[model samples]
Target chain A: MARPASMRRSRRVGEALIERSMLGCALLSVVTTAAILAILVRQTGEFFAEVPISAFLFDTQWTPLFADKHFGIWPLLAGTFLTSAIAIAVALPFGLLAAIYLGEFATPRIRGVLKPTLELLAGVPTIVYGYFALVTLTPVLQKFMPELSGFNALAPGIVMGVMIIPMITSLGEDAISAVPGSVREGAYALGAGKLATVFRVVLPTALSGIAAAVVLAVSRAVGETMIVAIAAGQQPRLTLNPQVPVETMTAYIVQVGMGDTPTGTLEYRTIFVVGATLFAITFAANLLSQRWARRFRER
Target chain B: MQTTVDSDACLSPPYRTMEPAQMSNPGVAAKLSVQELSAWHGEKQVLVRVSLDLPEHEISAVIGPSGCGKSTLIRCLNRMHELVPGATHRGSIQLDGEDIYASGVDPVLIRRRVGMVFQKPNPFPTMSIRDNVLAGLRLTGMRPGDLDAVVESALQQAALWSEVKDRLREPGTSLSGGQQQRLCIARALAVEPEVLLLDEPCSALDPIATTRIEDLLGTLRERYTIVIVTHNMQQAARVSQQTAFLLQGELVEFTETDALFTKPKDKRTEDYVTGKFG
Candidate 1:
């Protein structure tokens, strides 16, 4: 069959367009990842070269406000861990129980309604959650404890915990569901009741996936910037106390970015330093989850 | 040995005693007395008022064309069908005398008594040959110490010991098709059940492997009550002592294997037996 002249031209155009779009998208992804990594390494490397690695790692006091430079990493690390500890403490039980209730106990109709409702939290902007935390949760906690600051690790961590509920629940549900049906049947056939099967057979089998889920969530808490920046008062005290004000790495980066610090100055380099730290935590988490997921699949 | 005119009433065992029968011929006085057995899936009935006894201690094969409730009937023996969601069965599937469906009777206990080898040889893929032989015992929560002695013996009983003894720690799935089936049988036998139900055991293997399983079945009948369901008529003739012809969810005929093949009373069974039609 002979092709019509106009149809052949259109077909050639369509082929070319598709080929360009595919190659263009592939190039775009590679360039974006490589560019981000290169920028982070170059800027952060300069900051490290200027500051002694020992002083930056061990110094407890962070005096960016003073004339003399005193860069302490502990205060920032302490603040990050404190908020993460609080966030995880709040999120773990609530998220796990919610997942169990939703995945094992809920009717399909209930899950249909609840799953989308939970997923809606993920779509909500972190800035909006920060505002909600600063305005609402801070006031509520302050009323109970008069000594508690309005903007502190406590409120932001709690809000971040609430923000993470959807992620933890969804991931937990998927991990729980991925357990083979035959194992469940085998348990049932052995006279194990529904609760027994879940606790004993299903839970042990899904341990690796659950661990990966928790690691991913921990990294999420560590990397969260906006809520803490707005709600957690910018006093990077190296304390375990949740009631006290603390400046997380993410919050510190945002604080420096909002200022009139010159482009090539040490203060500008601080943002990239925090970014590199955040990237490390997230990268380690990704690697851990990948290993855990593969191990679980091999089982 | 004696032949009676009304053979439908009772087929006398050649040995007539359990003592003489354990090895030579386990007196096929085996009788099944299923009463008012009604099975359901949620509200939908699958086996409606199913009431029939299986011949005991003999290779009683259940044969039917596709979807004739053959698998359902076999699963009911080991209380396997009840594991499905919304599945329920009413009435009793009695053994020599005891009712298998009573409330006080544990379904697990019943399944332990009536061991089943599934349509598929589902040897635990992760478990080794030694572990596979002790699968039922493991699930039954039996002590590990006691199982060690029985595991080897059970494997030997299933005719897999010679082939697998050197590599008992090797995964069950690492075995050949015939070996896997035997491993499954060993797993079932480890529990020492009274009746062993083979649900189309040979359908998955090649002809040579199928023949080996059949030959194993013939030898196994001396120790346990064997009931197998096979699509291959040659397989049924080769292994089973009795044959029950089923069609469209109903039992058409149940008789001696030789008689079923030679002179089937029912037209349907005769047709099925004579290679005319299924």
Candidate 2:
């Protein structure tokens, strides 16, 4: 069974070349991440030289464009948190229920038809959702409440929640489906009804995957740009009221990026500072999700 | 009742309806009976006109080679067969003289009365050992005032209490394969079923674990009518009081375990038991 010496040598050399190419592909991603970290830290240091960290973090106002500027980040942070919280509140219950229905109860014919249609929602561009929020949803809200502003957080937040619904539903369905059939049969043999099995056994078993899905959806909502920029106004008011207009972290970056601020100015550099803050928040969210998911992971 | 002339005409009314007095001369009550039962997986028929009577509070074993429909027969006892897609069945399965498949009977109630343990150990991975035992009660919404006593006694019945009592709060998956299987048994016993069905329960266990589970079954037989499916001929001889041999979904022979092993009335049964052919 021994191979010839020359053929074996050539095969060994080919394997080494393929192994090195794969290693290079893997290092590319690591190097990209390191480069992004370096650039953000360098620009963030430059931003802090002119503006103190305390003022940037603790100040209530975010009026970097005004003649007398107040460089606080609270208003934008508040807007980001508020919109994301609202989106989660809307998405979690409906998305999870849909997933349970699809995974546990749907007939094969219905599931074949419904699953792809639900996933098609994820394929639609966010810009279309932004247009829908501004033109259609805003009017509907104003009719219900006369105090509703033309460009308000409520419309954009609701639209953003709609956009992420398919993400949670698809991922949650996969998690539920991954539960072992033996465990489910055990539940059934113990006289558990359909609802009991779904709620107690299947949902709990899939909790880690569902938690991972929710965290990923929250990260998506936090970094969403077009929906907030178009539907939610450019005003960065530190108000909890959904009826009023507010600007999010992503919206502010887009706002500054489209403006005529000169290169190297503090006003121009504000985008990177805001970008770093958003990146930190999303990174923390991702870490928290992985930790949460690991706790309930199936052995 | 007279035996019918054409054996394939097994589903006729008189043949299907056997009087309780006509069974064995020892006269034990029949807890469950399957008469002229036939099953199909989709369009393919897998079982044909199989019939047997299971005595109360005793272990009866069904032995057969692979693809012989042993598991399917047990599934039909608890109406688990109907859960499969496109599966259909003919004939009646009676529990205490009531046809379980008759109009207006709920399969859920039948399952509660007849609990099953699968070949593989499947404890609820997300649940603590204590919570796994309480799952049946929690799911059925029949919580007793003193939950600790119920959990302790169920685990004690399954012979897993001493090894697990100190760490009942740990996840069920933390235990060894044998302990996990016993936990599953304890969970099934928590509901207090009238009949317990085990489908090759010891197939996944070591010899020691298998012996422990078999010993527990000896004790459990005093209270519950038990039916087991086993591929191991020695296991059937050791544990079952009566044995039913099946071949290609037909009931080839049904008799006392000793008689069937020592003096098989049919050549097919003799061939199977002696390892001549499946």
* Most accurate candidate by DockQ: 2
TM for every model, in the order presented, reads 0.81, 0.94
Computed on C-alphas against the true complex, the DockQ of each candidate is: 0.20, 0.76
lDDT of 1 by residue, B5-35 (tens): 3434332322221111011122346455555
- Weakest lDDT window of 10 consecutive positions for candidate 2 chain B: B16-25
lDDT over C-alpha atoms for residue A203 of model 1 = 75
Query: What's the CA error at residue A162 for candidate 1, in Å?
Result: 3.9
lDDT of 2 at B198: 93
- lDDT, model 1, position B37: 59
The DockQ value obtained for model 1 is 0.20
Clashing pairs in 1: B30-B56, B32-B53
Off by over 4 Å in 2: A292-297, B1-26
Flag regions of model 1 displaced more than 4 Å: A1-20, A60-66, A97-114, A120-155, A190-196, A295-299, B1-32, B42-44, B123-140, B161-181, B206-212, B273-278
Question: What value of lDDT does candidate 1 attain over all alpha carbons?
Answer: 0.77
Candidate 2 C-alpha lDDT tens digits along A1-299: 49999999999999999999999999999899788888888888999999999999899999999998998999999899888888888889889999999999999899899989999988999999999999999999899999999989999999889889998999889888888898899899899998999999999899888898899899999999999999999899998889899999999999999989987999988888999999999989899888876764634
